[model samples]
Target: MWGRRRKHRPKEYFIFGTIQEEDRVIRINPSLDQPFVPLWFLRYVLYHEMLHSVVPDETVSGGRRRVHTEEFNRRERDFPSYCRARRWEEENLARFLR
Candidate 1:
């Protein structure tokens, strides 16, 4: 599922993508569809969402559910472009916020 891009205010937090375990749906932010958005970064987002299907969430103190557990993080880092994708996001996030 490709989600429509919403207008985001500057300095606000944004979700690049998400996965719904129950519905088995992975929704990607349409902002990434731009020509300037690198394919590796897009693949990274899809990979992150796909991981949610395989990695189970963890229950922590106060009964809180942690989706990105230590194990999940470890697996996420396995992606070849993980570091580059992160750096790209950090440097270019403001462009997408528009």
Candidate 2:
């Protein structure tokens, strides 16, 4: 779930993306003034959310968000070039429209 589309929208920045019980959807920030985010970076984030949707045992004990599990890391490892995607997101594009 990228986000639930309500009759009245909430703050747009908070709507970057979301994960529902069994599905994941990523809503790109259209109001973002950046020219474009590379495809691989988007795929990486989408994969991150997809992992949450696929694994049902993710549990949060308290305020901490413990969505990732050992199995989640293993699933993430299946992506051969995860490092490259992280590098692109961290080093190349960090700033965005406010």
Candidate 3:
């Protein structure tokens, strides 16, 4: 599955990458070039980004995207390595941002 920044977004589509809601941009990490990463992990990130579509507060306030709300965090933990994955992403986003 690919998540491209389309010229026109369809009514309903599942995105598997980070989406810049303000700009309607969808960015896929090339480092994830290989799809061998666990589906759970991939899904975790996708859903994480999808949350932005609903969380308007992330933009109005000058704060980090609360990818993990108290309930989101509690529920996301069930995905396994949720914390670890987030930490890994934080530590390695620089290498993967390209």
Q: Higher lDDT: candidate 1 or 2?
A: 1
Using TM-score as the measure, what is the rank order of every candidate, best first?
1, 2, 3
Candidate 2 lDDT, tens digit per residue, 1-98?
23334555454333334565633455554432235666676677677777777775655667566656788888887876798876765564435312
Candidate 2: deviation at residue 98, Å? 5.0
Q: Indicate the residue-level lDDT of 56 in model 3.
A: 48
The 10-residue segment with the lowest total lDDT in model 2 = 8-17
lDDT string, candidate 3, 12-61, tens digits: 43334777767756565444556555555666687666655664433226
Assess each prediction's global lDDT (C-alpha) against the native: 0.88, 0.59, 0.58
All candidates in order of lDDT, best leading: 1, 2, 3
Please provide TM-scores, in order, for all candidate models, with all chains considered together.
0.88, 0.58, 0.44
RMSD of 1: 1.9
Residue-pair clashes per candidate, as listed? 0, 0, 0
